[model samples]
Target: MAAIVWQTPANPPEPEDYIFFKGKRYVRPYYFEFISHVKNRWAGKTIVDLFTEEFRGRPYEYYESAVKSGRIQVDDKIVSVSYIVRSTQKISHFVHRHEPPVLAGNVSILHSEPDVITVCKPASIPVHPCGQYRKNTIVGILQAEHGVAPLFPIHRLDRLVSGLLIFARNAGKAEQFRQQVTRPYCYYKSDDVI
Candidate 1:
């Protein structure tokens, strides 16, 4: 039998990106630039109106304020709230992102192979970025901690569920694994059993 050697993740998480408070882990608020190109339907629409219709995440007043304060830009230049958008024009919206806290449990690596990496996912952490989470997710943590980027998960576990997760190191491996394992198996805690 070949001996299994354990190796540490190549990349470590940045200290400034996280905060620990009262036994919970939170991603520090940071400025994020959201970039997008004007769509055909958005052409001729005022910047404020376009934001209000497409991005309901923030209220109309917030978008208007952002435009006035230069937090929103068109083609890297500040524009008035009433500026009409044109097709192919680049838009950038800089906003401070705040992510909710999750449990302090760790994501433990179980196995690492040439084309696959497996980990024991902790509860309260999502498989990927969704909703109110970005850097606090399993994929984000692995990328920051293990230097693993562009990982493809074979299956996903809910944010509140804790279980083993398999990740493909590359896109080709991910596709191969998906074809081989037609029905991925998941282990749930007894409390979740019906």
Candidate 2:
């Protein structure tokens, strides 16, 4: 058997293993910034306008509360929703933190090789972090259980689907796998094609 170089930490942090967040909790803040490029493009635009443009799905009242709570800032200074923005300025926003739903299940490692690994992903586990899913994902499970790191998934299965999934251990292997899957294979020689 191959030697186990690393194992799950004896006392893994609560809710997850990775330390990508500050609080060591599953929930983390959402932060982003957009620098003004075109002059006067955002001259009359209010903070609410920019946030609404960025998050069209959210109701206007959501941003209203965010501005009131000082969660949104302009160049690090808390501003109201109606605060007008200027060109060449920086606008930043941080939303309230919330934890992603914890998926309860197991992931079976079907096969492993030097360059790739095959696993049977459980149902309801997302392939990657997005929206309310940060930890409690396939990648998180691999890190928390197995010692896999820097994993590159060659393909993805829906969050609700369970099936065999392949992951490349490195970038080179991932690129090679991508090329092989994307290009059509010709069994015959070039001369055989009419």
**lDDT of each prediction vs. the true structure?**
0.85, 0.68
Model 1 score (lDDT):
0.85
Error of 1 at 102 (Å): 0.7
**What is candidate 2's CA lDDT for residue 146?**
85
Tell me the lDDT of model 1 at 157.
Answer: 93
Candidate 1 residue-wise lDDT, 99-190, digit = tens: 88999788888999989999999999999878777789999888777777778999899999999999999999999989888966667888
Segments in model 1 whose C-alpha atoms lie over 4 Å from true places:
1-15, 180-194
Q: Provide TM-scores for the models.
A: 0.80, 0.66
Put down candidate 2 lDDT per residue, 1-194, tens digits, no spaces: 96422221132223333334442223233222323342465667887876687568687788878778866667778887789888777655554334464445567889999999999997777887656564567876786678776679999999889999999999999999999999986777676943
RMSD of each: 11.0, 9.6
Candidate 1, backbone clash total: 0
